[model samples]
Target: MKKSISVLAATLFLLIMVSSASAARFSIGGFGGLNLPIAQDDASSGALFGAKGRILLLPFLGLEPNFCFAKYGGKDVDDVRGKSYTQEGGDITSFGADLVFGSMSSMGKMRVYGLAGLNSNTYKREKLEDESGLGVAFGTGFEFFPQEMLSLEIRAKYHAIKVGDGGKVHLEFSGGLNYYFGTE
Candidate 1:
């Protein structure tokens, strides 16, 4: 945990310093979202949340790297005849990157954009087994500005986590805050 915190802090500090000196286009931000899982023969839909940081490469475009922590809520059903079955809600952890294509107002106020990314997910079950899978995702969202240096956004993504047997599809929704450092 200490190592993760240190990495986050260092990255934020670097972003602040770079954004403060360079064009206003450079900024850093974090986000959290909910996850919904599909096609888990033993599990139900659940919630997911995450955070990210971005560096603007152009006035209207940027590269974002993100980390997401998610949980799937589910229940199991059993048949009679003295037999018991297990159904469970699982927890997932994911990490990935997104190439963000969006446009902000000329004054750096409100913005709207789309994103595509590659992600990996790990699923955990109690007293059972764990699985890891790779996924592709795409989503879109809008950011609203209340201050020149800060804004809020809501985004969503569709994910396909695996191919072939026991594959799953997931949809997630999230919201976050962003800070713009300089001028455009």
Candidate 2:
């Protein structure tokens, strides 16, 4: 009985070490693209940029922390007596986390992934007070690896923010490159 227990413990330790060594390492990257306003015709699409860090726990699973900033196209605000006045638009900043599902292709050079997560958005308006809300985010993207430590990816994300009168959603499309380090 004692011998069996020792053998089992040794086997478990080996498995853990092997798994850790084989796991994919953490990666940090930044992306920039378009942020389009959806459902609300009042706002126009503009530039968007963000940064994110990814921790891949397994070949098919990862956790990502993200930060993004976006601008809305400028437009005239509160025209008094139809007189030309000021241009007003809003900017948005978002912080979020996502769970990513990924796998390599049959040939093993490319990786495709999908992500879903929750985000908090702060809306800074030109003529109004700032408002903040929590929203749901989901997206899909594909990565192509040209080397062991570098890759390129393009992704599209849909974020829906809850408000007093129902809610609004934004659709963002972006592309970026990443450098991976540490693990295989």
**Best lDDT goes to which candidate?**
2
By summed lDDT, which 10 consecutive residues of candidate 1 come out lowest?
Answer: 1-10
TM-score, one value per model: 0.74, 0.78
How big is the positional error of residue 90 in model 1, measured in Å on the Cα after superposition?
A: 1.1
* Residue-by-residue lDDT tens digits, candidate 2, 1-184: 2353355345434544654565558678999999888856457788999998776667677767688998877655455787754455588887767778877322366888899876667778876887777667889988887887778889999888765456768899999888787764
Each model's lDDT comes to 0.70, 0.74
lDDT of 1 by residue, 1-184 (tens): 3354455456545654664464446556777767777655566667666767776756666667678887777666667477766567778787766667877434656678999876666767788677777667899988888987888989888877763255767788888888776566
Give stretches of model 2 more than 4 Å off: 1-24, 75-87, 104-107
Pairs of residues at least 3 apart in sequence or in different chains that clash in candidate 1: 24-182, 24-183, 35-48, 76-87
Candidate 1 residue runs with Cα over 4 Å from true position: 1-24, 39-41, 78-86, 104-108, 163-165
TM-score of 2: 0.78
User: Total backbone clashes of model 2?
Assistant: 0
